[model samples]
Target: MDPFDSSDDSDDDIFFRMMYHYYTTDLLQPDPTSLLTRCAMLNRNREEGHKHLYRDYFADNCVYGAKDFKRRFRLSRDVFLRIANALESRYKFFQLRYDARDRREFTTLQKCAAAIRLMAMGESPDTMDDYMRMSERTARESLYTLSRGVVEAFGDVYLRKPSSHALQELYVVHEERHGFPGMIGSIYCTH
Candidate 1:
């Protein structure tokens, strides 16, 4: 991918926004300014009426378009819901698998967790975006789930770790790659 082909104007822009929180999550690398990157993707000369939300309201927080509020992009909760539902169907996601009683309440954060597990292991974002039937930003935001409410859902009370323990293997690999024991993941260790 050229990475500059925003011409399709497909709103990968919104999905890309999740890189903002993705990098910042789980003590992972910082995905702090993806919103700014998205801002830069907008073709000011080609598109009109796009009001840059992060730049306008979060000037101090964002660096890419701190001064320029010309472009606008935001992924709403509803968009995330449809994408999440679609992915659930394809993946045959059973809320029972996650130990949740009501599958209808599956939120974006839950969906994002799936995408993160999928992409972080080397799955291409393009493929994932297609599989999830949503833009890349949707993939990221669904995983991001920045709110404490969503993060809480990831805890032991809301969802049990899958018996397959794939994350456990990934944790071991993380430790092996880092030449340390801590990175494997806190779940496997007391620390």
Candidate 2:
């Protein structure tokens, strides 16, 4: 593993070594995949996939304490870590401004996702917890963490970094047959 051993190394080896230098944590994420598409590469069968994922994939400490989670939801190691990092950066200001320590549980990712779904469904924190099987406090906290100013307060210069992604237009239609808030449109359409 010489620093000057460029003769026998591939690009990936160098990339991983550079990544390791900064990230001391041994958490290399699994591939994050979309929910809708069931492609061979993306969709691993639950039975076989779960077994394989649980075996030697996690970096020694990546368990979420949600009983019956296999039946309740689907998430890979990569997504979980990504969400954790996102939440940490998202509310770094609020955390530091008040000298609050991070409650960086595996549930943080799930909590954020649940928060968005609850907001979209017009459900309050406590109500969302009942369906989500999450305690009320955790749900409330994640929602409170997603603040733009909080990130800047932590000295990130910007809340959200500018993207080079080319903008695209979306066409959405609504009809009266649908119920309340039936005429909402999102440019990104993630929700």
State each model's C-alpha RMSD to the native: 21.7, 23.1
**TM-score on alpha carbons, each prediction:** 0.23, 0.30
Q: Give the range where candidate 1 is weakest over 10 consecutive residues by summed lDDT.
A: 42-51
Query: After best superposition, candidate 1 residue 125: deviation in angstroms?
Result: 3.1
lDDT of 1 by residue, 33-139 (tens): 86356343322220111123223333366544522322221333343344444455444331224223322323333344335444445555445433334445545
Candidate 2 per-residue lDDT, tens place, 51-148, comes to: 33344234255354333332233544454455456665656422323112332232344455555545545567776433444556656766666433
How much lDDT does each candidate structure score? Answer: 0.43, 0.46
Quick one: best TM-score, which candidate?
A: 2
lDDT of 2 at 96: 22
Per-residue lDDT, model 2, residue 63, is 54
lDDT computed for candidate 2: 0.46
Off by over 4 Å in 1: 1-120, 146-150, 154-191
